[model samples]
Target: MPVVWSAVGAVVFPNVGGWLGGLITVRNIKPWYESLVLPKWRPPNSAFGPVWTVLYSSMGYASYLVWRDGGGFDGPARLPLILYGTQLILNWAWTPIFFGAHNLALSLADIGLLWINVAACGYSFYHINHTAGLIMLPYLAWLTLASALNYCVYRDNSTKIKEVKKDE
Candidate 1:
């Protein structure tokens, strides 16, 4: 198959999840997400769309590099690609878990797993293609911030906190 097909396939696949997440996000961002006691460090709502656009596109290209140079799923890239997919699924699940279901605890757990999986994915990619590995670094960094945010959100909104506030 042509490289374009592979590249496009890789690129579009992740965005499909992003698009789906957006659908879930749109319905819940107002009244639901807005009502949460988010941390001060949370980025402006406007920042997310652009940031994720870059991250998703970059990660998608990184996957393409691994797929092409590592010889697709039939070869060395198999495990790495699987790691990538696992992380992607975790990534995709975050929106529904947090925004759609308004379950901060489960979202935290999902992103926590995602954080670990992404590190492993990046490591596996590095072994196959250095650039692919390098490309995933930003994603890992973003997850660091995201994981912290998830923890904060979960903590701030925990039942314990709610009970404490009620007692006050």
Candidate 2:
């Protein structure tokens, strides 16, 4: 019921899943990740941390806005919150699938679903609070880049049999 409980506690802490997941999954993935035939425009590895930090914080705050405006779980915010949580889970799953398990195809599937969930979540949030929905746009933008990168990596790096040469 206190402001601190509502503000500090609510606004400041939603990324533990991401931080911990990255820590565990990324611990030994550098070499293999470095070996991938990435697109010419792929962001430097350092970019991801700062980008995700901002995005996570943005979405976290956005969720709080929706919760405050829509009266949390008992009201209109319920489905939006569930969509937000679902996207969070999908977002958290990507690194483990890509870096830990080395499964590019599956990673693409996960990210694709993540993108859809985020869009749906944003739409739902918009109906409740404009700021909350607007806040999700950057995350969607970043996901756009990430999804394209994932698709390219999977296409270029996955194994394939060379097509037989045809006689002229």
Candidate 3:
């Protein structure tokens, strides 16, 4: 039972950061986001919740495995943990920027950094524990798709003086 709880905690903790961010400002997101020209490849709105749930669970399990392996304090394993923490922070920041503050440009920048950090983490994880690293691969791939989507949103919505002038 204790192990089960710990496993559950492992999946939930890292994801809570994003969940909290989204919950805080979910109401403000639709106005700005709905007006944008999203890429055709954008997944259905229904896809995000379930996908993230699974991804975060895998991430948490990976964290638990790394921590339990006695590699948390020091080892090559520590590198991925550190990278994971960094990326998680960046991940949480994106929702507030895109949704709460309505700064899609900043969100795009954050997502770009998140993409890089995930890559770094993935590489580090591979060298430490292959399974732990493999667990993160889906997350990396999803983020890659997300980053492209974010880039498109930013490019399409950027405030151009020419467009403003034309509107006037």
Residues 41-102 of candidate 1 have per-residue lDDT tens digits of 88888887778888998899999999889888899999999999999999999999988877
How accurate locally, in lDDT, is each candidate?
A: 0.89, 0.85, 0.79
State each model's C-alpha RMSD to the native. 2.9, 5.2, 2.9
In terms of lDDT, model 3 sits at 0.79
User: Per-residue lDDT for 73 in model 2?
Assistant: 97
The stretch of ten residues in a row with the least summed lDDT in candidate 2 is 159-168
- Candidate 1 clashes between residue pairs 3 or more apart in a chain or in different chains: none
Candidate 3 positional error at 78, Å: 2.3
Error of 2 at 125 (Å): 0.7
* Candidate 1: 10-residue stretch with minimal lDDT: 156-165
Taking the candidates one at a time, how many backbone clashes does each contain? Answer: 0, 0, 0
Candidate 3 — which residues are off by over 4 angstroms?
Answer: 1-3, 160-168
Better of 2 and 3 by TM-score: 2
Models 1 onward score TM values of 0.92, 0.89, 0.86
lDDT (Cα, 0-100) at 108 in candidate 3 = 87
Off by over 4 Å in 2: 160-168
Model 2 alpha-carbon miss at residue 4, Å = 3.7
lDDT (Cα) of model 1: 0.89
